[model samples]
Target chain A: MWARTEEILPYALLLPSLVFLALLILIPMVQALLLAIQADSGEFTTAYLQRMAVDVNFNDAWRNTLLLIVLIVPLQIVLALAMALLVNSRFKGHQWFLYVYAIPLAISDLAAGILWLAVFTERGYLNTAAQGLGIVDQAKVYLSFENFGGLVAAIVIAESWRATAIVMVILVAGLQLIPRDFFEAADLFGANRLRRTLYVVLPLLRPSLQSALIIRTIFAFQTFAVVLALAGRNMPVIAAEAYSWYANNRDAHLAASYALLLLGLTIVFTFVYLRVLGLREAEVKR
Target chain B: MAGIRMQGIVKTFGKTTAIKEISLEVKDGEFLVLLGPSGCGKTTLLRCIAGLETVDAGRIFIGDRDVTDLPPRHRNIAMVFQSYAVFPHMTVRSNIGFGLRMKRVPKPQLERRVQEGAALLALEPFLDRYPAQLSGGQRQRVAVARALVMDAPVLLMDEPLSNLDALLRLQARADLKRLHREVKRTTVYVTHDQVEAMSMGDRIAVMREGVIEQCEPPMQLYTNPASQFVGGFIGSPPMNFLRGRTKAGAFEGEGFSLPMDGSRVEDGRELLLGIRAEQIRFGERGVPARVQVVEPLGATALVTVLVGKVPVKVDAPVNTTVRPDQNVSLAFEPADIRWMDATTGAALAH
Candidate 1:
């Protein structure tokens, strides 16, 4: 009796969270799949998914979402690695710099979008500064409706600035796990700084880089508020399209289809990241 | 092979001075050991020579080049850290060949040098294994191989065997000495273990409070330490010190007296008598004391004797039947005694 209770005790304690997860996530995921694949009459059909595939905004949303991910993820990783290395150097007042760099993490995605919008919007800070410096005779419309590149650039900058801190934090944790002696050994062996970082530091940081890539890419797939705030209808992303289908058109089935597509993309990218940065047990242990 | 020369090297960490105007010469192909206690700046000095730590005020010369301003890479030196520092991501072969790879050595030569280093350290079978797959001793061998394959003129080791088990350390010590003899690289090793210094160092520099107290051959350091600190640091059980005053051509302390040799001494001047445990014997007709403790080793027993409240240790044969509370007389040879000035702790010249 005692052995049975001991074996069942952990699961008994976890029952509430398991139930909560089923209700909040698993059940909704099943519902979404059903809604995506079935009609209101409770018969299996491909009508809603086909409608999502042929929607007017579907192609633009797919292209914009992929472009954003491709542009933002790599840019954030490089910036985060540089920031992590700078913070890890432990120079004087580095704590202040770390705190400042992490300030973006405390901001909401929409707030970050609005923050950058203030700089790029017409008569905003950039134009004001350019005009004050006599670099431009008139205020430039950097985020105008016809300027698709400007809108995409604004969204990329905002998203990279806001989300790079998360990658930086993970990388900093990884950098700390490496012994200082490895770097000293590299220096004594006559490796230049760049080569040392490329050969020694990067290989050791694979696990962290893998995690950062997966997390940022998944978050990038779900990006909505930032783009909605910065580009409005000028750019369409997968999440924005899902929201438009559900809230504006009152079509939950099409929204569910878009959400399923986003999920599929996230899984594929995560799998690719895991396979590319796979580590042996020996490398992981130390 | 090249000698290392440092002229008036000084390093300070904020308000605390770590190395204070230290200058030393390491001869070509010399295996010099910097032996000191923790925080003695021995490791710091070794790093300064390696160009890992820049001296605040000094000029460093590797062979004949003034390398004071050069980074470690440009200095053409190799270092084996105490942690072994084998790259976890790379195999032992890659680690051994990493320096050559950095220098872009030809593939054939790189492979040959890596093989030679692996063979020297008996790491041939473990070449394809990552550092995490190997034992601590094997990893240490990989670190040494990595340094040796560099074929750099100067090699710096910061207590490389310190992380190994005691039994492995003994084995590694002998292997390192033999390797050093074979390679003939100018190596500067930092360690706090006196046994390692005595067995491996061609010359040992005893450091204290950021300065070298004495730099000499192992036996010379044992026999003739420049100061009381060096004498106390270099020996097991250390040198026994008895405080006394000189009067009537004899030095008399709490419960002991020894005749002063040819050295001129003022009447009633304060001094300390330094003698090793082995130099003092329990025999007939000398200073009498009560045996407080008897610690037995396989070959010998250390008997602690108290003479008028001052405890002095004497080495006795292991089979001796000495028990606690028994009284014994300790005999000291005049030639074995070192007289030190009590105030400055400097060895008095005879």
Candidate 2:
């Protein structure tokens, strides 16, 4: 009597997409778990689990991935904040600037990698610009660092350019959603630019920034294309390790183990992120 | 408290004119309300004074200093927005202390002033709570406390109480009046509600289409609205108007006639006739009307009477029962009539 059968129609209509999502994401995830448990011996062994930590190459790949997250997370947040703030302001051709910032997001990672490679070439635009600006008479082969810094820089540039749009997009949305009256109230209080940004903008932006962080961190962990293009055959990213196990070693069991490691990393970080967000929500609730 | 003066304030947004050469003065320590329907440019005018919105052509003087071009932060004024606009992240103490902190008042002084503002707002228990953790009224009070912390001479509020529930709104209104008395800051409030404007303001400026139609004390606006629009807008149950011609021949009309007042001008010409619903009386000496509807609202009853071809609503004391579709008659002394220019809708000055 509370609600008629007609009211349930809209909910009933949602079952297909729900089922599709279950098949696409949930089923595969469940299959990975089953495959994790079932070996030829039909006994659950700790062999695959031990491989994730004990295998030197997998360990190094994960270590590098974590390193990438540590370096890129803060950098991406800062850059995105700057971009969102700049776009939030009034200027000539502001919309055009926003559209320009957003364009990298639409390009495929393969395309972006190829495009960035042109700048890295000896006779590329960087060399030409250096000659034109007279900073350097000729282009130097500068990108080949012995360590992973150059690779990190390349990934940063490519990933920053690609993923920054989404952060800027979210922060810009948050910026717009803040009532103009709040700023005016701050203004009335004689809050200077930095004070206002730190106290008001940052605090109001926590939930939004937290959400962006989780998404971007997961994205950073899944950083395959840019890492692959920049890091090349020698560097050991998790995805690169999986590819090596499958195509090179032709070991499906090993490849599945590497894939499962990637999944585990994602789940752990996601759990931590969700737990932090829940705490924040609880504090707000209190 | 400082008086605010504006000379020839004009604000145009591209081709659309928002405020067209508005000029007014707020007396020191006075509560002046800009009362108008939405988009009448009342908010824009308030913003121009608060230094939030710029005026295309104007000179604003706060206590005789030209503040028209100064940035809002430089202007010694505070504002409370309709949304409460409290910073969601800060505890109530920090939110209240934000202004003092901006000026880099020594930390002790900052703490003391924050405490003072909190005490004034009765926000002691909620000092550690964030804006998001508070009720709507609490948030609004925090916003007010934040405004108070500045200790500015003028407080500009744009529909500040509009977001509160009805009972809370009433309480907030009383608190605002009390706060103004204690703080003694010249306040300029903007609202469309006549009740709010009437009750809270020392003087009310009734605006229409970006122009001040009339500015007067509350009783004057009620007893003597400068125009028919002001009359209609500033009253509940509204002033009733009828289109008719005033002629020497018994004030002739299609379904109604009246014994014409001898002193009436524009005779034999079409003009609008307005009467307050409260002024109409029910009796046998008047014109017979069909009782169309009766709406009882506790203490008062509003009766819709069909007189000839025109329907008039009259407010009467409750317990006077009359069924719809019954016969009724209404009469009133002719002196209560208000006349307006039919074309321009401006009241004809008596």
Model 1 alpha-carbon miss at residue A179, Å: 1.9
Candidate 1 local lDDT, B76-101, one digit each (tens)? 89999988888999999999999999
Tens digits of per-residue lDDT for model 1 on A157-270? 999889999999999999998888888888888788899999999998899999999999999999999999888878989999999999999999999999989988999999
* TM-score of each model, paired residue for residue: 0.93, 0.86
- Any runs in candidate 1 off by more than 4 Å, and if so which? A1-30, A38-46, A122-146
Reference-based TM-score, model 1:
0.93
Q: Give the Å error, residue A260, model 2.
A: 3.8
Report iRMS values in order: 2.0, 2.0
The 10 consecutive residues of candidate 1 chain A with the worst lDDT sum are A277-286
Each model: TM-score of chain B?
0.97, 0.95
Docking class of 1: medium
DockQ of each model against the real complex? 0.66, 0.50
Model 2: per-residue Cα lDDT over B91-189, one tens digit each: 888889888888888999999999999999899999998777889999899989988888888898989899889999999999999999888899999
Per-model tally of clashing residue pairs: 0, 0
